[model samples]
Target: MLDQVKDAAREIADARRKIAAMGPNFDEEILGATRALYAPLIRKPSAAVKVTADVAYGSDPRQKLDVYQPAGAAEHVLVYIPGGGFVAGDKNLDGVFYVNLGNYFASHGILTIVANYRLAPAHAWPAGAQDVAGAVAWARANAKSFGGDPARIVLFGQSAGSTHAATYLFDPTFHPAGQAGVAAGILMSGPYLFQGELRPNLKAYFGDDPSRYAERSPLTHVGKSRTPLLLSVAEYDPAFLAAPTYELARAVTLRDGKSPSVAYFAGHNHVSTVMSFGTPQDDVGARVREFIASVG
Candidate 1:
């Protein structure tokens, strides 16, 4: 037993060293390695938790979601959106990814919803936000059936997912009847403000028009949003994302006359930050839990 513990520690240390060496770059190799290292460490949801998989929230097949229902009553419902750089991603990537996140949050008594949105090029701009709104509507209507409070739904997204959640939370154009239904929004490493040379993946969704980028950006409309926000950035995130994360925080502070909750995950890269959930090395999971509880 002692040897098994020692082996796990050594393996974790080795993985961290390799990831640290990769620095802040957004590399597929690093993402795959990070997922591989933590997948085994993620615990399966206990028998107390019930999972309803592949439920449709919208008409499109990509608009399906997975629900993680806790043992007893849940104070809040968290809708988690995964990142795929706008063009790709899913609710369950490689099976383990977001399933682990759902299990982790559900175990802590939060009814977790892992959702998939429409991808880019085929469906652009407001499509992602529209899917998010659909998912939120589903949660608000059906949360009580799963032992979750409908009024306390939290919107959470990572990377491109974050951008979609931010758009739904901030932009009045996407809001239903000009009302942001979420209790709070948690945006992790999202590109809130689109500026300068737009990447091909981003352009695929936002289109080739640079002039419309500002108006379409969530940052441009955040000033009018009164909903609470929790912003986070990974320590080893690519340089391009770092600016937008802090810029969004600054913009929110300027608008609200106070700073929102901000978290910096040290020693974590873009992918590892979300992948670390349910692992022993997880540093931000507790913060996320606290944020949800505080908001609730």
Candidate 2:
């Protein structure tokens, strides 16, 4: 047991050294590397919500959702999109990612939908956007089966999932149309506006065509969006993730009848900002609940 503890400590120190060596620009990579260690350390809350798994929203195998229904009848629903920089992420982890996010909110009485979308490289930019919108449409059509209120549905997104959620809601071209009937949104640590310095794998996820960037970027479409938005950034997040959230909040407040909120998660980094959802460490989850309830 002592040796195991010592080895884990060494691994943590090694992860920190890598972060120091690579700098904040590699925040996503550093977060991914440390997540296997940190994610398991955080305990999973006992299941208080009933789960319905692998409900299909699209023909693709990845286009599926896990619905978390509260103990009592639900009055609101949240469609959660997990993050993996548009390329890698899953809706379920033993105690991390969307599983924790879905369980926490559903346990709080909001019927939560955690959905998987097609990944990048093999499936790029707009594919993520399309999948998210499809999930929202599915949730809207199927909310009542789980005793949820469709009119009060909110979209909660983290990391790349935030980008897809914003795109589905904000972009004029989207099919399910994020702005049509969705009540609110919570977008956290998304690299929506800037993709200028992305690594090769990420760039491939967004596509090789630089010319399509402005055409496909969510930052360009926020002016047309009217959804009540809560934008969050972590204090220790990389500059690329933190800066645009501030800019977006400023833009959101300018629009008439749009109530926008912004928060900085202190002492948390990109992944932990979202991973802390079901734990006592959660600070942003409270804000998200407040935002959705206020809108309802």
Candidate 3:
């Protein structure tokens, strides 16, 4: 057993070292290259939970969601939006990671919904927000059917999904469908404030004009949001992301009204932090659960 532990430790250390060596867009690059390799490695939880499959929220095929209901009645609802830099990502990618993530939460008595949204280049900013809103509406109206509370809904997103969810919460005009509400938000590893460094793909979502970048950023409106936020960054995250994360947090802190809860995940990079859900090393998940409990 000790030898197995040692071997696992060495593998994680090696992975981190390689990730650090691969600079710009390292998180996206590394994960893209290794999804097939990681797929077989993830083990689903032993807990039994009821699940409702592939429910549509929007006309787009991508805007579908899978809802998981806990064994018992759930009062707190979690809506998960994935990140793909506004270009790629699905609820079932790299061995159905999000499905397992949803199950883990459901097993713990949190009604969880794993949502999908339209990707950029084909569809842009407001489109993603609209899909998210549609999903929120579906959850709110149907929460009672799944034994979940409609009032305690949390919006959770990572990377580009963060941009969309944050926009929905911060921007005054992007109302969610059916007047559904978001009680709290979890923003992780998002490039909310950075300018002039967007990669080629980001143009699809943010647009071509460099001068208009600020208009696309949530930083400009994050302070306007009254909902409590938990903003986090990985310890080994790139400099660009690290800076904006703290910048956003500081901005929220300086706000006259409610402030954001902040955290930094030690020994993790942008990818690892989100990928750590349901594992023995579930520090990030614990943080998320604690944050949810505090608000829910």
Candidate 4:
């Protein structure tokens, strides 16, 4: 046991050292590379589905989304949003991730829309939120045209994307244009509170506005919710995320909101959770699929 412990510690330390060496520019480079590398993979979706890229979703800058359609008609659609701490991430880069996830849901007869929202520093809190809302609106509006059921739209996101998804569903100004509201949401490792100095990096985007945090926090907005919610948090993510997910789930439950559900994925970390989206039988994927089926 001691020997195994030592070996594991050494491996962790080595991985940390390599990560540290990657430096501040690593995320930017990785962001660019990941997208370019995955673009081709996205173009070739599974044979069971039809894939479309760069569909005009919103106007101008936010007007981009990738749509995945199953061979057969679908009664439900899931809009998938990716995560990158709200700093630097794009849907084009996440094409492969969404493709596989779409394939999974498509196999289960659900169309999927992978949306790209404006990132922060250039575009702040509500900008990305608005972009996501626009994409959802597009999906809902064109669901029938795409052979999907508009009444069964589901919002799915991970990490920062989860944060955006939660806020959009809960945010008063973010509801789909002229639509009643979404049916359900699946949030994985999302932060429910940003009023304080919880995350320094997040401050650049959310800012120090107490009112914004209060109004924007999903936990605070759950009372008026008209949709069922499934909040899943990885057990090993940062406390800033994990703790808030637990607290928000409790608060929503206490508020008598749609019997909100909660789950913690064991043996999974933050990055691993979202990256495991379409992987078969993985902890995060299994929980997400189960939640989707229940909500469907």
Candidate 5:
């Protein structure tokens, strides 16, 4: 059963990559197809709400977030940000992503919040993070209204979203001027060094400021406070990028002053990690749920 599940998972992952490699013209179609794939698995579950609210405008005037929840859920909330190299993505297009995530947590009887923030190029580094932070504050203040547990909230993200999560986890200033911070966090396949010198793709969004890069890189901020975190990277995520992910994990270890638990999924690549959510017998999903449940 496990082998069969993994095999089917591989096929779905292949489709996910082909579409992503095709670029924007195919985004909606790919996302739509992915949603169809997940439809059967995503039971209506419990309570569900789709709420659109304003985030920070961030130089760009129009900035907003879409929040999703399960029916009658208690406050063990999760704030999920989508990854598109901090440049592209929308909550509307994230239906499949959030559906699987929301359903998974909802099945565990936990309230999950999937939010949209400003993206890059148009918005940039602190903009995306700031928008998410505002959403977090909103969640904290009204968690009870959504039937969620404010104190048990978790910040979770993948790829670029993982970057945002890591940034917020490390920088006490970014979360809020004086907020207590989240209980725990999960970063999937995120690069910790962001000084704009090493990574070309990120330079455009973060700019070429050594100080800004160092300050924003979570690795540089480790040990400030030990937030229980899980760092999971796909074993086959383009060989070139694997080292940075491990380095980021090591940073977490060094900063927390302990070896944080790291989960490596064999045969899984970068795009596949997010695709595995809510799939029965999916190893990565199981690990994520375990982490979220443990945190709760």
Candidate 6:
């Protein structure tokens, strides 16, 4: 046991070094390296948490979700949207990623939903938000059947997924019957405002119409929405993504007359914010659990 403990400590130390060495870049190389670091460390899903995979939320093939059902009754349900740069991402990436995320929350007695939305260039713009609406709709209708409270559903999105969740929460155009339809929202490392030079991925999703960028941005609509929000940015997030977290928080504070709950994860990059879910170095997971508890 002593030897095992030492080995685990050494592994964690190595991971910290690797993550720190990688800096705050948001490229495939960094993302892939981060995944490689965490994959081996993440334990398999607990048997106590039952997973129902590839459940359809909408007609589109991409509009599917996976549910992680806790062993006991759950008071709140979490709808998780993953980030894939608006071009490519899924409910399960390389198998371990979101599965670990779903398991982590469900194990804590929160029924978890990991969802996939249609990608950009093929689907584009409101499609991701629309898919988020569909998934939330599905959760609201079916949550009771899965021992979860429909009225206590929360939206959690990371990166591009966070952008979609913010759009769904803030933009009335995507809301069902002019209703936000969610109790609370959690956004991590999202680009709320689309200012300055557009990235290739953003252009693919929002198109070449620079003039419409403000109208399409969630930050533009944030001042009007009254939904409770928890925003977070990693210490090592890329500038484009990190800047908007503060921007959205400021918008929320101005709207609500108080600062919204916000978190800054030290020593983590954009990808590691989610990748660290089921590992020992999971500060983000603890914060998320606390947020859900407070909201639920």
- Clashing pairs for predicted structure model 3, backbone only: none
Could you estimate the TM-score for every candidate?
A: 0.95, 0.85, 0.88, 0.80, 0.78, 0.96
Report, for every candidate in turn, its global Cα lDDT versus the true structure: 0.89, 0.78, 0.78, 0.70, 0.66, 0.90
Point out the worst 10-residue segment of candidate 2 by lDDT: 15-24
- Give candidate 1 regions above 4 Å deviation: 1-12
Candidate 2 per-residue C-alpha lDDT over 1-296 given as tens digits, one digit per residue, 9 for 90 to 100: 99967765675455445434544554446766656535654556556679889999999999999988998888889999998767688998653666777788888999999999999788987899888889988988999989899988898888889988888778868744344558888898886775456677668777667777777888888888777788898766788778878877777777654547888776566776666676554467787888888876
Between prediction 3 and prediction 4, which has the larger lDDT? 3
Minimal lDDT window, size 10, model 3: 33-42
Error of 5 at 94 (Å): 6.8
lDDT per residue as tens, model 4, 1-296: 99966765564454334333433232456444433432332223467778777899866765588777888888778898888788866675433655566666676678888887888777777776787788888987898888988888889888788888888887667884544367798888878777756455587678767667787676777666667888887655667668878887777778783347888775455555554444432456667767777765
Q: Name every residue pair that clashes in candidate 4.
A: 35-93, 58-63
lDDT of 4: 0.70
Off by over 4 Å in 2: 1-29, 32-44, 175-179, 195-198, 257-259
On a 0 to 100 scale, what is the lDDT of residue 109 in model 3?
85
Q: Candidate 1 lDDT, tens digit per residue, 11-50?
A: 6677578678889988678778788878888765678889
Q: Which candidate is the best by lDDT?
A: 6
- Candidate 5 local lDDT, 92-167, one digit each (tens): 4545655566566665666666667776566667776676677678778877777788998888887778887777
lDDT of 5: 0.66
- The local distance difference test score of model 1 is 0.89
List model 3 lDDT by residue over 19-130, tens digit each.
5565445554577644533344455765568878789987888989999889889879999999887889888774467776787788778999999999889996678777
User: Candidate 4: misplaced stretches above 4 Å?
Assistant: 1-45, 176-180, 198-200, 257-259
C-alpha RMSD values across all candidates:
1.7, 5.1, 3.0, 6.8, 5.1, 1.4
Score residue 89 of candidate 3 by CA lDDT: 88
